[model samples]
Target: MKLNLILFFFCTLVTISWAQSPNLSKYNEEIKKIEDTVKYFEVEKINDQFYMLIGGGGNVGVFVSDKNVIMVDNKYEIIEEVLMSSLREITSNPIKYIINTHYHHDHSDGNRAFGKMGVPIISHENAKVRMQKVTQLYGGIYDFIDGFVQDKYPTEALPIITYNSKLTLSEDGEDIEMYNFGSGHTDGDSIIYFKNANIMHTGDAFVRYGYPYVDLNNGGSIKGIIEVLGSIASLANDQTVIMPGHGNLSTKQDVLDLKKSLMNLYQKTVLGLEKGLSYQEIADSIDETLAADPVMPGAELTKLNYIKSIELELNN
Candidate 1:
């Protein structure tokens, strides 16, 4: 009887440990898949010192300095070595800081690799908290039709530095400002602006991808996104270059265009609600021109998901 009791306690402890630890096997498999797609990756020079790495995951903004490099978003894990190689092609400075625009795996999964190298990771406090545990991602047009589970990140992969609304890092005579404009794509989205370079890296907050995705399950709302976009447009000037979370380099005009599109959608959604239209009815009523907007490639489903998000926001 005592032997059985001891075994039971031991098994219980093991179960608890397994629950606490990140799924290393799953993490490794994901890394392997990302590495296999390295051929799609390309690095584009934005200016004298800043470069944009595209393909694989979210766009990465690389700010090369005389002594060190500051990365706005560090794609995936295995992709870090590839990113480092790409940086070496540009400059020999070591990566000194990693700033996560948000806690999404595509944008910040490389945090584990960089964190392991003792590179300090900075993000919004909410992002740090979200990264520390398993997260559910919803509102995708396809793969996330139901929802997707993002496993918890290991301790070393988590952000070491966190801020509430704003934080500034002065490096190489530049004041890099990171600002969280409340909840939009996620509760912790950060829009980073490089003062000297006049370049802004608007994480998932602004994407070139057709139809914006609002992660309602993760404190995201279309209304919030519209508000955030307005703020970003106001902060940007005609000369400012924008490095979107998942697209080619953009300009302030592009930001305004996206903002205008979102605003139009918000107004339409509000009008539909006022008319007592169901979410499906509103989605179906979106005209071809609006649904076929270049930003929303997956027209029908994307419209549905977007309308659903707006409805959820309004009802709440």
Candidate 2:
């Protein structure tokens, strides 16, 4: 009996460790090292109330008021010290609200750190549900799908408040609204708008990165992206400053251009599917002109990944 109990306990420990490894082995070593060497973070002031925190997993939005401060996305856990230091440069008010745009670690990994400091984190209901199931520290294909072991997240890292469609926050004169664009980047993807500032923080749904990854396993689809992008473009005007999940800040026109490119891809995929082409065939027969469009600018591998995601989404 004693021997059996010892074996059981040993196995449990090993299982837990494996479940929470966070796939450090999968990251690019050189890029990770470069990001690590940066001791400070840069903040770009969008206007009087909104600021963008650059150089992390995702672009963080910092909104300041006389009484309180609000944040959108906290990047990674490794970014804690520098993120906090950068926030201090803007204001010393308490961080009243943290809006997590999605469940991806690059955007929400710092939840544990911020939660410990007593800040309330808010996210779409599905984001909270997915975060509860996430075991790894990295949010990628493996974590989004079923390849890796999933360990439960620490209580501190989970979002405390969750909304179904929309939630609005009033900070001084600025009205911050959070809107959920269902099943685009993830089941719980959200887009944040600083109404007074005329700035939109488009989570992973609209990124400046080469090709956006559609988390098909997590209820993401290219069709949903098409709808979401159209809605986003319609909501903006010439003056709206768009803040993407990655890359430099952009304008409304850029978002529209990306939408056009994605629409073209979606049409081509549909056409190929109608002709009964296999995934490989469809990928191989990509419209070269559309693929080379400047709007997307994603690498071949990234585009291929998107193609795979689209195929999976369509088949299912």
The top-ranked prediction according to TM-score is 1
| Residues 1-316 of candidate 1: C-alpha lDDT, one tens digit per residue | 9999999999999999988864455445656777886754587997789999888789999998889999998988867778778778888988889999999888998897889999999999999999988877763443343445677779998888999988999998999999999999889999999987899999999988767666777787678888898888888888999998887789988877877877776778789889999877776665642344343355666777677667767788
| Per-residue alpha-carbon lDDT of candidate 2 for residues 166-237, written as tens digits (9 for 90 to 100) | 998888888888898677887899899888788999988888765566666676777898788887887778
What lDDT, from 0 to 1, does candidate 1 have?
0.82
Q: Look at candidate 2 and tell me the lDDT of residue 304.
A: 58
**Between which residue pairs do clashes occur in model 1?**
210-295, 210-296, 211-295, 211-296
In model 1, which regions exceed 4 Å deviation? Answer: 1-32, 140-145, 288-297
Give the residue spans of candidate 2 off by over 4 A: 1-35, 135-151, 278-298
